[model samples]
Target: MRIGITSPVVTAVPGVHSPWERGAGIEELGAVAEAADRLGFHHLTCSEHVAVPADVAEQRGGTYWDPLATFGYLAARTRHIRFATQVLVLGYHHPLAVAKRYGTLDRISGGRLVLGLGVGSLEEEFQLLGAAFEGRGAVADDALAALRASLSRREPAHHGEHFDYAGFVVEPHAVQERVPLWIGGRTPRSLRRAVAHGDGWVPFGLPLDRLREMVGAASLPEGFEVVLSAGRPLDPSGDSDGTAKALRGVSEAGATLVSVSLAAESAGHYLEQLEALTRIADAVAAEEGAA
Candidate 1:
């Protein structure tokens, strides 16, 4: 199983943010990215939100970094680790714009980009951005199709309900022939969308039994990834064995990739937790190989 991390300190959720993160800036973010890279984590993910409504800011902890800018910055610093937008709201921007931004990011990052996308849940945010909120699922489906076309070819073309363009060249095509598009969300419509359009599925807050059922129902192609969030804090010192066991369970439940979040108070603490999790991942791989 591949292990990835939703970068700490990047999106400061009330409980997830470390004490040191209040004063932390790009330097601290770089340290965390470097540590994950050095420790052999598969990918480092960032979240996105253009603007948060005042009512939701408290719950959402409104400090989201632009994924393109953040990943572009980290791409220069890390060599092996991939950069992912944990879930970019596809409805918020034009498909060509996303293609231009993230496709270039993939080229600059040496093809290490995974475009994790979603229809987005925030009605108010969509309203603020002047994006239609009612039929977002349809919008996202069309957007994904347009993005696929735009990223795969130098002279890209697409004709759809939401977007239409042809006979125009989109230069600096993505390094990968097809940048992986992972759909995010756990709704039935989301799962259907994943099976139909996604190269991977990223489901949040899903229980093990439901995950198993969903994975079984979907007709995933060979090597199609089921990426799951660990959903709880990972504490290396308190329960290393328990962490391994939980991850092993996730692996067994049909997840090809697991993104873990660690509870840490400082950069040093974060690195230590990453090292411990790396050990756990290595052990899991070894055991799986033997099995």
Candidate 2:
């Protein structure tokens, strides 16, 4: 039962954004990455959005850092921690382009990259990017196949409904023989995609029972990951025992990797919360080991 963190202070959401995050800069982001690495977190994830429409900016909050660039920056700052895109919208970019960007990221990060891909929900953003908003599921399915082909070989080729390319080598091929591809979402179609194509399932906000049901339905291969969001702050008020219980429940519920998010007022507060969460995770792991 490994633990990962959704990178804090990078995406600003109303009610979720800490006051200090508004003033935070790149250095602060580096500090958080470094802290997650030092604290033994399995992975640090960043969200992505090429652009947010003005009408939805109020609800979505318009401050999304480019995941590829952000991860590149963090790669230099962290050693052991894996970097992930919490969910990169597959319909927004060409498959080969994504393959190249993330493949290079994996190469530079020493094979520590988890590609969490999704068919995005924002219709307006899709319109802005000129990516077909409707039939995005089909688009994502094709894109996933194309990405698989492209990332696995130096001279890759793919012929799909949306993309076609061949005989072009993607240099500096991914460090991992097969980069772990995680599909994200809670929809039935999403679950099917995970079972059919993904190396892992990355589901957010699903209840424990629902998570177990979904995992049972999927015919995951051996070592296939089920990464679930913890769905709440581990220590909302510094309750380590409570945090441990919550995490243990998640592990028992069949989450191979649990992603924990913390709400903090400052970098210092975020680091403190991370340390507390790490202790709770370690305790849970120790008990599991003993059992």
Candidate 3:
């Protein structure tokens, strides 16, 4: 099993809203990325959001660096670890622009890019980007189609309900023939989209059984990925080795990767959580090696 960590978005603010508000600064993010790389993690994911929702805006320090730029920053600092967008909201970006940006990042990072794509529910973000919030689904579908077509050929053409283009070869061709695209969302439609266009499914907020069922029902291509969130504290009843034990079950369930999020309290807390993750990763790696 591969292990990864989520990068904390940095911003200036106090306890204002959800944990999303308390993103860390760029310096902190760089340090964490370096740390993860040295400690044997295989991937690092960054979240994207234009603004925090009104209700949680203050409590959550709502600033976010453009994911592509942030990944560039990370690429300069780390080696070997793949970079990912935890979920880049499809509606907020032009598909062609995203394809170009991602392709460049993949080249800059030497083929280490994972595109985790999602639809944003934040209407404020849509209004800000001049996108129709109601059409996000259609937009995402079209974007996925465009990305696939454009990335495959020297010159590609696309004509879809929401996006249409002709005669463009996204240069700096993705270091890989295709950057691995993982669909991110927890809806039936999302599963179908993953089956049709995605190389993997990255689901959040679902229990183990539900995740298994979704994977079983989804018409995935052979070698498709299933990555589960592993940030929240597992029940403490399993003893000192419980974390490793739980990770083993997840790995046995065919999770190609597992990402653990720290309960952000302070730098110390975050680092402590990362240390715990290192131990778990070591255990999991050993199990996989033995297998």
Candidate 4:
């Protein structure tokens, strides 16, 4: 069972670590990354959001360090831990530019990049970025196809509805001929997208029962992985077993990766919460060994 922590974004904070709080600067973010590396976290992931909605606006801070730049900083600071974006809002980025960036990060991190993607839900953000809001899903599909083609060959070519080019190749190709691509979202359409194109599924808003149902219906390829991380309520008293139960449920539902999220008030507070989760990971590891 591999265990990892969500990045120290303000969304992970309970209250006091709002984007306005300035609680964790770049330096502290680096410290948090180093701590995860030392603590045996398998992968460190960050969410991408240009703006926050009213539904989440007050609960989570409205701003975040761009995930790619932050991961580049982390890649320089850590050695073994993998770097990933929980979901990078694929439609918002040009495929060629994104391909180049991830390719560079993959090389620098020795091929430890996992590019999770989504078609984002915020129309306001789309308007802000000057992207066609209504066409995002179709554009995202095209982008994914282009990305797949661009990353497969030594010198790749692509001509798509949203993006077009020929005789184009990204230098510093990913360590893996094709880097891992995980798709996230909980709707049936999203699940279908995952089964059709994604290497993994990360549904973040479904209940355990529903998650199992979706897993059964998804009909994802054999060996295709699932990562369970719904930003829902967590039992505070579960101690170490709280995470274990979640992970066990995910495993039974066919998930191969389990991630735990910590909610706190600041970087220090979040680190304190991580200690509690680490204790759980240690206990889980012990139980597996004993069994």
TM for every model, in the order presented, reads: 0.96, 0.94, 0.84, 0.86
Worst ten-residue run, lDDT, model 2? 231-240
Per-candidate RMSD, Å: 1.2, 1.7, 3.7, 3.2
- Measured with C-alpha atoms, the lDDT of residue 151 in candidate 2 is 88
Best TM-score among the predictions, by candidate number: 1
lDDT of 2 by residue, 1-291 (tens): 588987776788665667789999889889989998998889988899878888788988988888898999999999999988988999898988888888899999999999999999999889888889989998899999998888857898999888788979888778788898999998777878987888888887678988888777767789888888776655634777778778887887789998887877688888888887877777788899999
- Model 3, runs deviating above 4 Å: 10-24, 58-61, 152-154, 233-242, 252-254, 263-276, 285-291
Segments in model 2 whose C-alpha atoms lie over 4 Å from true places: none
lDDT for position 208 in model 1: 88
Runs with alpha carbons beyond 4 Å of true place in candidate 1? none
Highest-lDDT candidate: 1
Expressed as tens digits, the lDDT of each residue in 139-171 for candidate 1 is 899998898888858788999998999998777
Q: What lDDT tens digits, residue by residue, belong to model 3 across residues 180-219?
A: 8898988878878887888888887677777777777666
Candidate 4 global lDDT: 0.74
Q: What's the lDDT for all of these models?
A: 0.87, 0.85, 0.74, 0.74
